[model samples]
Structures are given as structure tokens and as C-alpha cells.
Target: MARPLSPKLSPSIIAQAALDAVDHDGEFTIQGIAKKLKVSPSSLYNHIDSKADVIELMRGQVMGRMDLSGVDSESADWAGSLRIIALHYRNAYALNPRLLPLVTAYSVRDATTIGMYNLMAQTLRTAGFDSTRQLEIITVIDNFVLGSALDAGAPDNVWAPGEAASPELRAALDAGLGAPDRAQKSFEFGLGLLLEGLAREAEVLG
Candidate 1:
């Protein structure tokens, strides 16, 4: 016998519902969101026009959670800045790993997302990379960070070397697997390797 105190329909509500769907279902449909919100499909359209639109909103929502206000390419250490950015980037996406496939299929138009990439590019440029090299480094970091985010879902014993596994591979697994922070430690380790390699490559090209 009482009216609801709040309006259920809003851009942020739509985005959050879509994110929840993606987090639980690996993808979302307008129909799915409508059902979850107990609204008709036409109602969802009032807030979001297309899957792409919803995705951009969700992207912005996730990207906004990262603290990039401290990113200053002109003053920060390029490698250190990139390391911080990559870590934050990976952690943000790790929260919604199920959304990865859907988001990756769409071109990034979210301003926060674009700004993060621009910061990465600018930092690489400050490290003496040319435009082309900046693009390459960004791609490398993107691939690695995205992969690392997805990898967060893996079990603690990420690799289980079998009886037929190579001794070298088994040795490496023994050194690395079965830890609570296996994925996280591996991500940091790989990131360091990648950043170091980029620095060396930048030097060689200079």
C-alpha cells in the first residue's frame, strides 16, 4: 500500500544491472536486463539504446573505479607509472572477467577508458618510444593485462604437471604453482619482464 521511495530506472541503474548480468551470465541482453529490473524491454530502451551503449556505460563504470588522477606522464617514471596503471587496469577488469569477451568485441569509446590508454601512450612516448612503438607497447600491455585479468579466475594450483610432463615444465610449476597468490605473483613477474623488455627495446631503437 506504499509507493516505492526511489525510481528504479536510471542510467547508472541500467549499467549496474547490466554489469551484474555480465558478472553472472558472461553476457547480457536488453531483454535480460529488463527482466531483472522487472521492466519491459521498451523501458530499457528509454535508458539505453543498444548493447554497445550499455557496454560503454558499464565500461565507464568500471574505468571510473580506477584512480588515474595521479597519472602524470611528464613527471612520473614511465616504467613505474605503467606498472601502477597496468595493475589497476587488471584489477578493475578482474572484477568482471565474464564481461571480457563481450567488451573486447566492442571498440572502446568510454572516455575514462580512452584516457587510460592515452596516459599509457604518453608515458611510453616519454620513455623515448616513437608513435609506432607506443602503439606496439600499448598492445603488448593490453594483451598482458587483459590476459592477467582473465587469469585471476584460475585455481591456486593453476598448472598440474602430469606424469608425462617435461621435467623443465614440472620444475617451473613446482617453483610457481599451488600458492594462494599464484596468479597475482605471476602477473607481477610477467609485467616486470615486459616492462624491462620494453625499456631495453626503447634503448636499442634510440
Candidate 2:
């Protein structure tokens, strides 16, 4: 006979369990998570519909940790608020590098994700941009942050953790072809540039 499942665990609990498995084990598998949580695999199914649900739950958990309230849309320094928001995202990703894959793959349909997008859109509106242009500006900023983080985190010749680099790669690295602080610097620079362009466009269009 099959053992009865515990009613003590809720969906949120199950989702959190799954997150713990990924955070500690660096992998997400049904059996692995069940074993870690001391629950029957079937029990988890009672809480979550699929592995996709688990991933979405974890992604929401990560995004929920971000503090978007600090971004004051009514403040005169709207550009600075945008910069702070970008820095918050960068710092969050830097702390949890594993979440980068999820951030890249996850869509913005979830409430937590939508909240993030809406916050950015609101900031843009506060800066005197309309909805359409706000979205474009948000997209531009997101892409810049994503690309910069990925580039900074990518393994370069000198910093490669795998087998030693080839001689030519090493020579190229020796030629001073990299910026270790490129991610932070580039993020600020890109935000400033984008905001400036947007301001110019607003003036021209007015």
C-alpha cells in the first residue's frame, strides 16, 4: 500500500524546498528534491503541477528579494533612481550567479516579474516618456545590464577555471584586452548614455 502524504506541506513550502535543493545541490530533479525534503515524490506533485512550476517559483523567489520601492518615480532625480535600480539588479545577480540562467530564460508573465517591468515603466513615465518609449527604454536598459553582466562573468583566457589556456589566448590576455570592472562601469555608462539620448529625443519631439 502507498504511504499517505503529509498535509503539513503547502505549495509555497514545496517550492521553497525545491529552491533549497537548487541552492545547495546546484541541480533540480524531482527525486533529488523529494529525497532532500524527506517527502514522497508524489507528495510534491500534490503541491506543484510540474518542474516548470518549480522553476517559476524559484525565479519569483529571487525576483521578490529585489527592493523596487526605493525607486521613487516622483523624485526630481529620476535618472539617479534608474541607476540605483540597475545597480540593485546587478548586485542581486552578482550574489546569486546561479540565478543568471533563470533570469535569462524566465519570461515576465509572473506577478513578480511584471512588478519589475512596471517599476521601470513607471520610472520612465516619471522621466516624461510615454508608454511606448518607456518600453523601448526599459528594453534597452535591460539588454545592456544583461550583456554587461554576462560579459563580465564569462571566463576569459587569464581567468579561465578549466584547463590552462592556449599560448595565443594567454598572449592576447597579456596584451591588456580586458576590464575587470567593466560590468559596473559599463552599466553606469550605458544608463547615463541611454538617459541622455532619451532626454534629447524628448526635447526634439516636444
Could you say which candidate leads in lDDT?
Answer: 1
Consecutive 10-residue window with the lowest summed lDDT within model 2: 154-163
How many pairs collide in each candidate, listed in order?
A: 0, 0
RMSD of 1: 2.3
Stretches of candidate 2 above 4 Å error?
A: 1-27, 152-182
lDDT of 1 by residue, 1-206 (tens): 99554447987888899999998878888998888888889978887778999999999888888997887897637889999999999999988888788888999998889999999888988888889879988999989999999999877776765797798898888887877888898899999999899878867866
When superposed on Cα atoms, how far off is each prediction in RMSD? 2.3, 4.9
> Once model 1 is optimally superposed onto the true structure by TM-score, how far is the C-alpha of residue 62 displaced, in angstroms?
1.7
lDDT of 1 at 77: 70
Model 2 over residues 64-109: C-alpha lDDT tens digits?
Answer: 6788877787776777878887777666555446555654675655
Worst 10 residues of 1 by lDDT: 3-12
The collision pairs in model 1 are none
- Badly placed stretches (over 4 Å) of model 1 are 1-6, 161-167
